[model samples]
Target: MEETGYTVGRMRPEWGKGGAQSLTFVVTEDCNLRCKYCYVTHKSKGKVLNLETAKKFIDYLLTSPDIHQSDSAVLDFIGGEPLLEAKLIEDICDYFKIRAYEEGSRWYWKYRINISTNGVNYDSDEVQHLIQKNSGKISIGITIDGTKEKHDLQRVFPDGSGSYDTIHKNLKLWMSQFDASTKVTFASEDLKYLKESILHLWDEGIYNVSANVVYENVWREGDDKIFEEQLKELADYIVEHDLYNKEYCTLFLDHIGAPYEKEDFNNTSCGAGKMLAISPDGNIYPCMRYYDYSLNHQPGYIIGNLEDGIDFDKARVFLLAMYKYQCDDECLSCPIAKGCEFCQGFSYDESDSGTNFQKAKYICKMHKARVRANNYYFAKLYHKTGIKRQNFHWKKELLFVLDDQYASFCSYHNEKISDQRMDIELVKEGLKFAEENFMKPVFLHSEQIADEYLTDYEEVEVLHRIPIQAYREDLPFYDYQIIVDDTSIDLLDKIPFQSNIIFNLSYENISKLSDMMEVVWRKTDRINLNLSNLSKTSDLSEYQRQLEKCAYKINEIEKHTGMLKELNVLTDIMFIKEHEGCPAGEDSVTLASDGHFYVCPAFYSNHLPSIGDLKTGIKIPNEELYRKDHMPLCEKCTSYQCENCKFINKRCTNEVNVSPAFQCKKAQIEEKTAMKLQKLLEGRYEFTNIISAKEFEDPIDMVLDGKMMRGYF
Candidate 1:
């Protein structure tokens, strides 16, 4: 019953795109320095992986059918200090490559040698020679906590002195040779140095920083608050410096603070049992953590030894079968449990009953604090970049954001674009891309731009809409559509008869909205309201009352005046039986003035990453998340009228597939109101699909409660 298709949530970076099988070799349990936070408790100069033993393991690995199944492999080397036995590692790697080639193994061509070191002997001639010998196949991640003060606080020598000077001197040489990231750890004492340490690393030209707090119970009572404050301070600095794209900190990733999907069920935190780890004495453990020196209470969890093959029963039943269900019930159903990280080895070490299945929850509060800080970071980043959080409802038609005026009409009005006319040739280029891709193009621009550019693309057929502040009767009325504001609805009387006009209702003018809807209904049935500004804390009952009153008023007018046309939120859903939510990436894409294709106009206006450019065509990363089947909450939702806005979803929930609380509440209210409207218009229209009421207000609650199955539609 293993689930598939869910991502590893965002704690770990998605590296090794080819999905390499990890084979870790604990070369030695010896080191050059005794760091205070070192996990290896039993560092012995006596224990070292001999060349013959490593060769034996390599032969077994290359000949095994299970190892050959992987298309790629990572020959990982770990130690109290991996570089301490640099010559042994070099010989092991050389022997592995030769044996794999001799056996015609797949790993010979696709393999990488990964090492994590303390950087004490990084500048040594032996280590330099080893690195040079295996130039293209090796990746080393050196450990440097942060600044001098931060590093000295936790990572010190046995003599109780800081090793920062030596590590700092060697850092320049390491940076000169490799553009690799440094690993940093945050403990209770060094929590205050979090910001400066990250900034210091950035100053040292190591822009990619992978830093995290220890998952031990060593955290003090108020350490979570201090952690939160430091993260916030770092977030502000990152925003102010505008180094988000240029720099990276694992804690502030874009994919954090999101709900877990159903497919994410039973997912383990790290690749523990799936990966292979061999000790110096030739005994095999699941990972480095299960090695005797790293564990506290028990001996190594040995699956087998080099003398015998792997014990499949112990490996599979006890190790490979590890999943999230094995954790406590609170963790099993936790809403913010997606990115919560845990160590399988640590779980076994800290478990009260000596069972690895009972995952240790020592990092729960620290993770929560990180999630909050991540939320603040992303919110501020989105705000600064003009990324809107509301649902973008542009139906299947492709929207061309011609200029500032057009973008303003379609966007949430967060930031007004400067008045700059897009080049006519750029429009032609976009039109050409759309035509070749078989997309229907609709242009949103001012009247003057339309006048100048509409004739430029005579070969392609385009639907152009003009956004005007006031009515202009003398304007040419060919096949053009006009987007009229709420205040200008009274000018409909002067508009030509049977014209296709879209009336944009700004809800700020609530009193005049009813009157304007009547005028818009009389003039034309096309109506669009900017309901994105509706607050989640607003009076839902009053909003429902207002909607009911408007629907009733429109119904009464149609009945008394004998008008054939009647358009409102209630009747709109009745006419369309199927779910007609905004399919931003699927049905439609927006081509901005920059000649790039965005998911929608909002994305372009907000400065979000475009799906593709003209040269690349369209390439959306994680495109499956945009579809309804992958959306856990929306897939089970009965709210067919829901906009299912990806922009809003990502903004509020940090995920595109999951709906936000506000969006879920709003969709629920609309669906309930639509059900009532269906009853009111029972005999008037022959509805194909009846709107059914749901027992729950939030779709996510039903999902978490296991009340609704996925793909409920």
Candidate 2:
């Protein structure tokens, strides 16, 4: 049977947004240089996007109801080297410029065009003339990786002599020809020497750069240790130099430093298939990464008749389908959900399947680090809301991250190489980003800055305590952890949690643990609920008084573990529904797993005690990686919401209550998600209570301080 896995929920992208600000037009597949990592399929193909089809694609794009809404659009002419088919690109741009005014307001809705070139064959006068004519409408995105040694390591001509001189010369020529408004980007393999690369470009008199990371797994895997180390190195470097300074030009940095009020970007999801891309052959695609459905396998030049071949919506569905396969691991359920990639794109896979073997392997090595982050994030929950309850139960020797689903999450954390689904689209501007950013910076150290600029900005986590609502006895392992008694905790302590011991404990552990601790919703209880009637008053009349009486109860159901859906944060919210920030769009509520759930493991004000048990069938191997007290972040973050560590309580710190690394990362993601939600819903409502990440010192302090920062009215 073909497993569709389980039905995750429907996604609802914010309407009216579509297409990227940039689009790449392939001029030709024929290249003067041969980089091995180039698309595997591009090797045998001698195809090019012919002139006529290119024009039609542009026409469709200009007239596209979907494309025009973007703030601006840039046409990036790419190739095997865009200059190889420079003449075709010229024709395409010339045609668009001359016709741009001729078409309706739709055609000129602020569209700017650009092209990407390798600097080979770029000095021709005629080509320069055409570019001069349409320079206002077009800017070129170029590739220049490091110095001569690095550049030649990959980008070389047919016979293999380094072409750095010619490329730089042409780059100078391009710089002299265009002004700064023309979006000039410098790309490379990763985000390494951005400062040096930018300075390098500046030395050549070019201003404006857009850096990108190379995406190749073309989809292959196996370098889990290497790539993770590479990324970790980069992140450490970022932390070391504080390179991601609050610069307006750097979007990621800008986002990182956004004020609490400013960080809110209401919509959490990107508009996938909406914004369309038009290839040189006039076939439309969601973005440049996709092969043109109209031209990918074309045996010859295609022209004029290309309009008949594109299916925009179907492709959208295909890509949207990929997201469904991701995030079933532990990160999503962790209190901090947004900082991580949420999908396999960050790591390459063995095949087209979207498995992150690196994610599996690397996560195995450093997941404790992330659990540290999750705990750190959960600690922030308390810092933000100022509610206190035990997340990590600290016995004399063991710290428990008390959740049920953590086993699988821990297993998936390794960045496994799987044959699951994959994202086939390739990000075109990889090399340039690496070249510009990864190069070393000689001047950054000597540069003078105001003391205020050097000031420290503490990072904060967004914490979520979700409650599971539905009842499902048939499949009862959603974050279920055997709440063993002190004696049982001690008895189990001697078991040495190997797979065999885990297997042995899986059977009787549930009932045995039940005798010790209370779980959220067992099927035996009739009052278990689902999505439709979440408000306790909405239940029977007997429940209404109880719901109204307590400090956090909804109805007769004094305790509940409602499933935390994609739309909302806590599954079993105890504080106040009014206190919950707001739904993260309707679709957000649906991402939470169904069946019985709990409002995080903290058990502060929730109805349900806890959820599933790890002994059943979760994938966590090193269980100690999930505890809050096991983490360093928990000690630092006092925010009640921020410190409500899920993954920690469910797994890691369970053995020692000390945090692992996952807690830190989870904190960052939650903070980002909350900021995103705040940005998204800010103008629509006027909520009296909301806490930002910056206000708190740490989880312990947040609890001590109690939640009135920002002075909620």
Candidate number achieving the greatest lDDT relative to the actual structure: 1
Measured with C-alpha atoms, the lDDT of residue 595 in candidate 1 is 78
lDDT of 2 by residue, 89-120 (tens): 77777777666668654435566666666767
RMSD of 1: 17.6
Off by over 4 Å in 2: 1-24, 43-46, 59-72, 177-213, 218-272, 275-284, 292-309, 312-322, 325-713
Candidate 1 local Cα displacement, residue 319, angstroms: 7.0
Number of clashes in model 2? 173
In model 1, where is the ten-residue run with the lowest total lDDT? 1-10
TM-score of each: 0.58, 0.44
What are the Cα lDDT values of the candidates? 0.72, 0.36
Q: What range of 10 consecutive residues in model 2 has the weakest lDDT sum? A: 438-447
